[model samples]
Target: MMTTQGGLQPTSNEANMCTNDNGSQLGTRIVDEIMAGKNVFFDLPDKLTGEIWTLKFHCIGAQPGKEIVTVNIDKAYVAFYNVVYIKSKLGYSGRDFLFYKKRCGIDRSRLLALDYIHQEEAMLSDNMDERKISFVLTKDPPSDLEVSITPIKRPRQRTNVDEETIEVSIDAYKEWLAILQHDNPETDLMDDFREDTIKTYKEWLRHQGDLPDILLYERMKNKPEDVDIVEWHYMVLYFGSEKFQKISSRNSENRQKQRTKHIMGYRTFSQISFQQRDPETGIEPTDLSLWMITHCKNDEWSEEASRGIYENAAEKIAEKIYQTEKFYLTREEENAIFQTTFKETTGCKANRLHGHGYLSRYPTRSQVMESKFLEQARATVATNQKNIELESQVQLLNEKLACEVAERERILQEKMQALQEEEEKKDKCLEKK
Candidate 1:
């Protein structure tokens, strides 16, 4: 049987070895096996056990069929056993070399000896010697030493872009309002305009600071409408004009009460509900509702949003009163109140729906001036009422004087006629005697 130099048992199927004098026979048999392809060729010198040598066996049959192979050893332990072998037998009987290595202290690390074969062989031929090999072989040996090797890699790094999207909920919306109020207190918080208004507020809170305190403050605060207009200018930049239109359309009574109470603490804006006929069919109770003026387009002041189209109807009636010299507000007061600018063609258009309430509903420039003129005319008539009364008294006195004069003249004439008649009668009596 063939034997290794370390003095272990002979490998099974190997012929028994002779003494040192018969070493030639061992060399001849090993050479013949290499030439015949029955044994794999090893680079180690023949009889490699003389100086504590090791032989690396590589499976080198080009395409040989599977067979039971036994490794023999005499002077040294089998440092490793390749697991590829179906079964391994010892010098006399079939036994696995792996089991043999485990019983011996050679594989205590549970490391298969194949782990060192390639590296050890490379060292003997190259720069690695007894010193370097000891250092390398004793440490956790690299995987490359195995008969088969695998590529190793590091894990990829994670990033923010890889995160999943999050959705906004109603509860989350309410909580956000609370946060905005806590942080900003100078603004009027009106939940009257829900969508665009809330969106604008959120954008503002986000840009308030670097590594913005939006989440932190939103978590702590309870009011959003309390945020000031100027402070939220940055946030407002992100909102488009379309969002405003949507908010104007969608903010209804039900939503307004809930959203506004949380945001502004009070309802500061108007809410009007209304409905109209479908126009496809005629029906008496077609629709009914109040008009919401806020939703009216600034340019299109039509029935669509302008509930009060005749806003200056009262002003027109007041103008009629002015033309008749009626004095509601006097000339001096009117002049002092409204100073018309004569320089511009369109100084103050009376048609301008400028002021909020009903009093000075001047819808056009000429109408406003007319109002002032009427006030002046009324005041003049009021101041000259005493002259009118004095003229009436003088006319009455002149009529009574003319009537007395006529009665005196009639009485004088009658007296004169009677005297003449008496004189004539006396003359006639004298003549007859």
Candidate 2:
């Protein structure tokens, strides 16, 4: 529709019908009619059924969320093929568009529908959607004329591909990633994914007194890094379709090691010389492994000392794994190995809380079993004594060898001097002759 900003008063659409397929006069709104006594009319071009038509209007000082003037024009007049343009009479802001017929007009029932359209021209306004449009009429009625036209493209044919193939559930992926990321705030992410995380997890599991699932839950919740991807794959593939379940050790080398370590404080039963048998059938092997005993001593153990103990234990467990011991352990189990295994293996300053009797399978069984503390102390003293005596013998041998070499040098020098004297005597005899 044609819009004028200054001078001249234009008549209503009834007085001046827009005969030209091209709109000859300014557009109309009911609010405009009441306020400015101007008429707005909708005109369709002749011989145009499928032809695309566009509606253009001018808005004056219209805010975004606020409603501009509304008018009841023929719904048919409102009909056109494609685009709508809105012009502002205040100043030449730019190009603008009105609400599409397919959106707000036809979809009042739909919850997700566009309520209004923004005029592209108004975008130039500092506030854009915040400003309104103002228009003036012409004294001659037809100040300017123009027809808004828009081209329409035909829709393409549909294909039969499945919806699932085209769409991915980002929500589900986000949840999975969240689970993977959940971890101890204090623990570094790099360490969690590293090999050490799994070791720490295993140790936690061994010492934890909670139910298997509960234990797993707490461990995973506290330290997500401890969960190895390989372990997850193994659990899912071999165990069938399940979340997580405790596996029995009867058929598992790992469980056996766990049991051996539990009772004897070593991951390798070979070192401890212990065996687990089936509890159901007296002679057969049992499915369950025995739980190892662990104690926390407050008086003798500070955090620093315990840390060293834990680290040494971890290193020792790493050593065993490096040696290709025929067993597997969870990360936490390995950590437990560091603590329990190191104590039993090293038998150093940190001994068990209560002096327990040694098992028959213990390597130092007879010696340890006979007089636990006294025997260990004597063995340590004897070892030190032997080391000192061997060093003294070596020193004495070195000194004796040095003295023998000096004596041999002295005798050789005397022999040489005697030979020189004989030579000098022969020379004297020659001179006399």
Candidate 3:
């Protein structure tokens, strides 16, 4: 169906109706390529699907508790699919999707707080079924719109595959490229991302001083300026840091210029990224860029607001998979995702509170544990000391009582002896008289 800015773009789905033979082809592509972990994302052509919806996938690895891969639609597209596609089709049941914003969790709060979604168009269809939580998207819609995955091909062709390069998660690679692009706006695509991002990542690796043989092989080229997209993607994700951008190998005035550019790029990424400015007008980082940038913001005000988007990303990636993927997570695993997000979001804020409060005195994680342990130990020692002092005082009181008793007994004996003498004197005097 066609969708407009304020209303659904109603489009006819007559051209791409699936024939009996080709009905499962589109579904098979989704299962084989996206869910199978061969590709992170691909653009779905409207021609193949008869324009039912514009589709893209951000595939995430099956999380620890999850057993199968999950497919997530971009948040912007959720509404149209909910209201126009599913709701409009009378043949389908109301028990289909869980309204993303309505989902329960810390992330739900975060997504609700986004400035982008408050717009009129962002509102989800109110008529959706509240009861059905888990449903699968079929390869063939009743509209007969066939679906297919556009396979992701690397920009550069490598005849010989280098097994040394570390295999990275697709979501992580996308994140790496996004951060790289935000830092360097001069390049629009990850395949084209170069200069500062690659250099900083390489310098970061050199600073670590234990560059893996695979990463080292790329940097050890005959020239100092060679760039590999895959190699740089891996290095930046695992090891890249602003602090380590100036390693020993990069110790010169020219190197300083590169660092200056890198710093400027980071500063630019943090400031204007939230604006969501178009690349033509200013800059647009990747979809994931917003979440990554928001997490990195330091200022308290911007930080909280940015964290909303950050948690939103986590929810979208992990929880959104439940709605669209074939291999469903158990109810327990679903709850686990919610709890994990709640902790990541709330736990970070708790850390900040500790930093600002007196608890800042306890810095590191182990140090915090040690400090708490020490406090408990000190409390135990103090209680033991108080017990010892009380026992000593009780012993001293007993000794004093014993001494007083002895003194009293001695006085009584002496008095009795004196009385006896007096009595004897009186008797002698009487006898004498």
Candidate 4:
């Protein structure tokens, strides 16, 4: 037995399998073994307990065995374990491994069987370190293991050219929108696109003080790389319009009325839904449960307050579930129950439902009228202020012009007087002579 670092002891047979050859030779040997229909196994050291863990790779295909071996190994390591750990375990440096992989012609893809095996092993090992693999692979993967391979969809590569400098025509913007709509017909491309552009516009708007319409429109320099120049220009103009300004302002006030601020950063509701599963049976949680899990974070809402709100919501959800003889509530029912429960408990309605329901309450007739009146009043005041400034500028210009005209008249008068005096002197001199 040869004892490696991290207290990992490989048996004589396992020790003889991995030679002190360079990466190129080792890669050649690995390919030759796969071609001979033999499984390759690597002894790796567990980071936590320093135990020897065996990783086995078997090529299933009879013909083109090299492709199968290279592809599967590449996928397994790239998905579950770091490529560097595998390189080091094989006694090869990073640069050497890169050249080795290139020489082997490995193509990376999803490995569902490997992923399933990794998940099972990780659960048994209780290792949360995703950067390192701590579990052992079986000599043969389970017969019942899921082997469905899904191709990873890569996003369209964007040009490195600066977005602001890229001049996009209206036709190009339309063509891009058409392509996007054609590709994703199910998606509300325009609405989603508008929302993102509006968000960018809001960020720019926040920094700008009171500016004239022309200046506000002219100062839209921060264009998102995804947004075409023409589209961004049109969006900026629309967002800066008086109508949209009123809408944005109203939305801002509504947002301010929200009580619960979710602490989930960069995590989608779907991702959070996975965490809300029942530990025993793996049954997915209802929408209500998901909302509570996402919102009841101690950092954003106090533990006491969160607990109180959660308990109240849970009680209400439980009663509903009991009455309906159902384990889960539909999204609509869940939203209504949550809204009612939150209002009952807190004595106030939630402004934004975090995309769970309608964002704001339907304004009453009186409220709508009042909002309209306020908007109009603001617009009138702004118009009056703008007109006053323009009038002041015109008056100043007129005054300067009047001063110039008066100075010219005075100079002309002075010149005439001098000429008259000179002529009179000439006449006197002629008469004396």
Candidate with top lDDT is: 4
Off by over 4 Å in 2: 1-372, 395-399
Candidate 1, residue 403: CA error in Å?
0.5
lDDT of each model, Cα atoms only? 0.36, 0.38, 0.41, 0.51
**Candidate 4: RMSD to truth:** 30.3
In candidate 1, stretches whose alpha carbon ends up further than 4 angstroms from where it belongs are 1-379, 383-387
Which of the predicted structures, 2 or 4, would earn the higher TM-score when compared with the native? 4
Better of 2 and 4 by lDDT: 4
Residue-wise C-alpha lDDT for candidate 1, range 173-258, written one tens digit per residue: 45666676778866465355877677656654554442234543443344357664334443443232457647755765436432
Residue 262, model 2, lDDT: 28
Rank the candidate models, highest TM-score first. 4, 3, 2, 1
Off by over 4 Å in 3: 1-351, 354-372
Residue 210 of model 2, lDDT score: 28
Q: How displaced is residue 412 in candidate 1, in Å? A: 1.9
Model 3: per-residue Cα lDDT at residue 219: 48
For every model shown, what is its TM-score relative to the native structure?
Answer: 0.15, 0.19, 0.20, 0.28
Clash-forming residue pairs, model 4: none
